[model samples]
Target chain A: MRATTIHAPGDIRVSEVPDPTITAPTDAIVKVTAGCICGSDLWPYRGENPITEGDTIGHECVGVVEEVGSEVHSFKPGDFVVVPFCHSDNTCAHCLHGAHSVCTNLGMTVSGQAEYALVTQAEGSLVKLDEMPDASMIPSLLALSDVMPTGWHAAVCAGVPEGGTVVVVGDGAVGLCGVLAASVMGAEKVIVMSRHEPRQRIATAFGATHVVAARGREGAAEVKEITDGVGADAVLECVGTDAAMGTAFAVARPGSMVGFVGVPHGVQLPVQKMFQKNVGLRGGMAPVRRYLPELLDLVTSGSIEPGLVFDSTLPLDQVADGYRAMDERRAIKVMLDLQG
Target chain B: MRATTIHAPGDIRVSEVPDPTITAPTDAIVKVTAGCICGSDLWPYRGENPITEGDTIGHECVGVVEEVGSEVHSFKPGDFVVVPFCHSDNTCAHCLHGAHSVCTNLGMTVSGQAEYALVTQAEGSLVKLDEMPDASMIPSLLALSDVMPTGWHAAVCAGVPEGGTVVVVGDGAVGLCGVLAASVMGAEKVIVMSRHEPRQRIATAFGATHVVAARGREGAAEVKEITDGVGADAVLECVGTDAAMGTAFAVARPGSMVGFVGVPHGVQLPVQKMFQKNVGLRGGMAPVRRYLPELLDLVTSGSIEPGLVFDSTLPLDQVADGYRAMDERRAIKVMLDLQG
Candidate 1:
């Protein structure tokens, strides 16, 4: 089985790896149909995060069930399924509160960008599609595995009200998906802060009413101007950098909250500003598993087209190129065609 | 008129000062019947907060309307009123969102412990009682101006669910009031982290189901043990110190939020922990004016006795002693009897 592995910074390769086997009673094997690169994956590729040589990477996938352990009752061979990046029992106290990311029996669905991926907590981690779908539906369904639900978490935490204005910081795939989430939630004005033209186009298509192309202080000022100095009703901080966090708080209206989904890296929150403005901070690792069911329905029902975030698609052998394209910002999201 | 003044960290005096006159069309004068020292006031009295020499202090009071500027219509002479510590129009965009503290035209109610105090934004800052009440009601109504509403803010931000467990991180007047608030909101278990026996008694009276006399790490361990390791459903961070904030987050359940109302002073938030736990931080200065009506009704209707938090009552001339008692922790709260 061909899988994506990282040797070091700037080194992503597709190499033959051993096929996955059910390792536990609750495990299931997934023959991945398609998987995509996430902005978060860039951390290791850029050497910002330590990574071991030859370690398989990837945590998002849509696939056909190849096999299952005896305890896996919800899924079986030949079924199409979407896998949450993190697996959970979905019955723990945390999961019951829709915080599956913090579930007591949590497991990571790693090595997903491959021919075969082993999934633990199969019944709770994998969402079985009602029927096998055509090629076109796979991309959007695959999105439900991580980005879509993560974006939805940001919107939910920000408490984006209907007919309210929202400012989305960052223009990566997740940020673009955040725009789509805000739109689907009925946000009247989805203001996006993006300096990139290609990402801006996707943002507009996803329901951004305005775009602030400037970065840093000027960008926040622009948003403030657009909002008539009242600041945004809510802010979606999709980038985890300090500047992005600063902009998110700067543009948040009094009593509004900043829904942060980006994995924070050296980000120092402006706590005093948040207190004074009554702007709250909520969101961490998204409970994507809990949100997968609803988002899967939306994608399958054609009410949303989150798959448009994927600007580049390649064969499984070109997984290295996918990582490079994503790292170079040449692609918003790079989908690896694992079936090939 | 004589008002409490702060000359330095340990120096407080009630000195003769010029009577306040209508400085704005929105101003009103009140003859204070009762005013109480707040825990926050101890910040400057203890020299933690910067204070100017002979600066007038005090922000909580219940009084009879003495005079009103032409534009002050909501309150009039002879009517008893509870004045929020901060004044606002209550008609600004922020105020309409129930965030009076962020009102566009906000002002502070200084010199509140004096015989007569001038209030700005009278229509928005002063809540008139239906009628004058006996001396017994003065202390409780005075509590509404700050402590009660501030505590309520903490509970509201924490989203205290009915029948849920709530942990209050302070034993001060505000934290005691927080126990009262969590009780009124129907929390099944209200836990207070208080080592002081007197404050613990007040907490019990206000509806604390359990009292964790331990502080720091041990206190958190006790709370975890009490909750069977699940943690509290909501946490009210009534103390602004980093240690208190640490405990608030340490014992908060996943998907819970920490409501903070103590004015943050050099408190660095544990942002990483907040994200990892799926716990949220919300709340700042309490919008006491917006909550005044509901709390006023609760106090006037004889449903809660927050006034019991005041352990010592002193005459107006003894304002300095009131500050000293509070600074020494000899009194939970000190009431200045202005009518004397």
Candidate 2:
């Protein structure tokens, strides 16, 4: 089986690797139908996160189950499913509370950017589709595996009230999806903070009522101006940088909340400022599994086109190009067609 | 009028100050019947928070309306009321959203530790009592002015679910009050972290199911042990120091929340740790005015005795002794009898 491997910083290659097999009673083997490069992947790609030998890459994908272990009762071979980014038993106290991202049993599972990946705790981690989705709808379905649900989590956790104003910080696929989530969730005004024209267009298509191209204090000032100096009712921090977090905090109205989903790195929250403004902060890894069912319904009903985030698609062998395109910002999301 | 003034750090005196008069159309002059020393007030008395000349020291009090400005329709002279520590118009966007602590039109107004204190935004800040209560009930009624509501805010904001486990950090009057709040809110088990014997007794009386007399790591470990390693479902952070905050974070269950109401100073949240655990941190200055009505009802019905925290009482001229007893931890709280 061929899979993406990072040997060193910026060194990503599609190399032949031993195929994954069912190793636990609750494990299942998934033949990857589609996968994509994540923004978090850039962390190791940029050498910010060190990579060791034989480290499997991606953590997002949608696939068909090829084999299941004895204890896997929820799925069978050939079943189309959305593989949650994190594996869980779904029975742990955390998972029962809808925090599958930090599931006490299986924790977080990786190795989805491959032809065949082993899925642990299959019963709780796989969201089976009612039937095989159309070939064209695969990208959107794959999004429910991680980014879409993450964006949705940000909107929901931020307490985006009905007919309220929301500010989305970031222009990546997740941020664009946040605009869609906020819109579908009934936000009357959705503001996307983006500096790029292409991303801004995607954001508007996804239901962003306004776009602020400025950065930092300037961006916050712009949001304030638009909201009559009261700021937005909620702010979704899709980017995890300190500057992005700062902007999210600054543009949030007093007593509102800022929900962040970006994997934070070297970020320190201004606690005093948050306290003074009575701003609540809540968001971490999204409970993707909890949101997959509803999001899949939305995709099937044609209510949201999250697949539009994938600007390019490549064969599994060309996964290197997909990574390069995403790393270089040439593509919002690069979907890898794994049916080769 | 005689008022408690902090001429300098650690220099408190009962000095003659100008009588407070109605300065705004929304203002009222209250003849303070009682006032109390707060844990936060100890900051200036201990020289941790430097005080300047003529700085009136307290922010918690209950009194009778002595005079009302033209726009103050909520109260007339002789009406008894609870003056919430933070003044608010209750009509601003923040106030309307129940964040009275950060009300836009009227910011925090101090000067409660005096014979006469000015109450601004009277219509929204004063919670009028139905009738003058017995002398014994005055302390409990005064508790509604700040500590009681602040503790209630911690439990409420932390989203304490029915029959869940709760850990209250800090054994001060507010922390003890938190135990009562959690118990009344349906928490089956309330764990209080305290080392003082008297405070522990008060905590148990206030409905603490268990007491962990450890600080920092040990305290967190004790809480974790008591909850069978799942950690508490909710944690109330009543102490503002970094150590107390750290313990609060350590004892919270994943996907649960930690509500903190102590005025944070020099506290930096370990965002990465909090993010990984999926713990939500929410709570700032308590919206005392918002919770006053319900808490007053509880007091009137004898459902809670939060005023029992006031272990000592002194006359207005002995305000310095009240501050001393609280600063030295000799009393849980000191009630100044302003009428003497």
Pick the DockQ winner: 1
TM-score of predicted structure 2, chain A:
0.98
Q: Compose the digit string of candidate 2's lDDT tens values, residues B1-340.
A: 8888888767888888889887789998888999988999988877788677777878899999999999988799999999988889999878988889888866444678888888888899998877888888899999999999999999987888889999999999999999999999999999999999999999999999999998888888898899988898999999998888899999999888889888887898989877788787888888888999899999989999999898999997888888778887889999988877
Docking quality (DockQ) of candidate 1: 0.78
Task: List the lowest-lDDT window of 10 residues for candidate 2 chain A.
Answer: A103-112
* Model 1 chain A: lowest-lDDT 10 consecutive positions: A108-117
Clashing pairs in 1: none
| Lowest-sum lDDT 10-residue window in model 2 chain B | B104-113
Interface RMSD, per-candidate values to 1 decimal: 0.8, 1.0
Q: What digit string (tens of lDDT, one per residue) describes model 1 on residues A46-128? A: 99999999989999998999999998888889999999998988888889888889888888877888888888888878889
Task: Name the top lDDT candidate.
Answer: 1
TM-score of chain B of 2: 0.98
DockQ of 2: 0.76
Off by over 4 Å in 2: none
